[model samples]
Target: MLNDFLSHLFPRVVLRRNLAFSYTFCLGGLAFGAFLLLLLSGMLLLFYYQAAPDKAYASILFLESSVWGGGYLRSLHRLCSHTLLVLLMLHTLRVVLTGAYQKPRHLNWVIGCLLMLLCVFEAYTGYLLPMDQLALWATQTGMELLAIFPCGPLLRGILVPDGIGQSMSLLRFYALHIMLVPLSVMGLSFLHFYRIRKNKGVLPYL
Candidate 1:
């Protein structure tokens, strides 16, 4: 009467033969590690980051200038975000080169692509949260470019229900940056890992 799939799904181990670092170069694991660091640093930042367009920049300035080690935390967050991007790209490339995307592994490949896209969007949405001039203008230009595409205006509306730098827009971005995107990434990561285990990815188990 219940799924219990997770119980059956987990508890399986990867083959020792597949454990060679050269097989994957650990890019995926490194990417996941960077993602975990981002989560930690980002959570700490939440206490200091103001979400409103009016107060956001000031709050970040205060965090950097006044809060002890706050600048370092922000820097670490930024570094991890960039590192995660690079690691994901390299990991995807390695997967393609290794033919991991063939046959039963294709679904995992799609999931991975979604993960990369989510990370990118998470960065894009977070960029405007501080409400700084450079980010504001850059994101505005990006949005404008997006509008040039078919259905782009509709997508933009969903992303920013009000004007750019407006309260609603900032809040929406804040929500997505802190909550929705992270949760979605974590959820998909679980599924991705499960699929890897199920498919005996990289090498056969047992």
Candidate 2:
């Protein structure tokens, strides 16, 4: 029924028989489902989440202790982020093991990889918003790890001009987490979906 509706809207759209439930495991679909949950919960979080360094942790505490269901909402967001990353990895692995990354599907494979990276980056940005001890130490450690990369210092400077756990860094992470990264992910996801739809289905093994 869902395929029929999509086919009605896009007459050329097709799903080959090989796209059976067992073969695909619907990993991509599950990842998108997790993304949708994260998007919704994160948006709801924005209503009460203060990005200021001084109030960041306080805001989280307030939400958890005061707002009904706020803690559960935050937990859901965190869980979905992890779930999406895991699902992406599984999806990528499945593609590799099945040779789905060959020929015309290579572009979509790259998009999938980019989506995974974007999701990881999104998690990193969100990890620091709480401004707690663990967040500070973890972010500082991540920056150190990043510093070892080529042009790492330059990139780190751009990401955290005032240093990790500082006001400026908090604001930067907040902006990237809430706006930039999400927009990039959404745009790339659209491209990925379009490519898949255009290609119709995984091509027969050459």
Model 1 lDDT tens row, 1-206:
01223432344555576566565787876898899999999999999998887789999999999999999999999999999999999999988998888887899899999999999999898889878998899789878989999999998998778888899888888899999999999888888877776775354331
> How big is the positional error of residue 29 in model 1, measured in Å on the Cα after superposition?
1.0
Q: What is the lDDT of residue 9 in candidate 1?
A: 37
Model 2 gets an lDDT of 0.86
| TM-scores for every candidate against the unseen true structure | 0.89, 0.90
How does model 1 score by TM-score?
A: 0.89
What C-alpha lDDT values do all the predictions have?
Answer: 0.85, 0.86
Write one digit per residue (lDDT tens) for candidate 2, span 1-206: 34533442356634565445576787877898898899999999999999998899999999999999999999999999999999999999999999888888899888889999999999999999988999999999999999999999999999999989888889999999999999999777777777776676555511
Q: Give residue 199's lDDT in candidate 1 (0 to 100).
A: 72
Give me the displacement of residue 27 in model 2, in angstroms. Answer: 0.6
Pairs of colliding residues, candidate 1: none
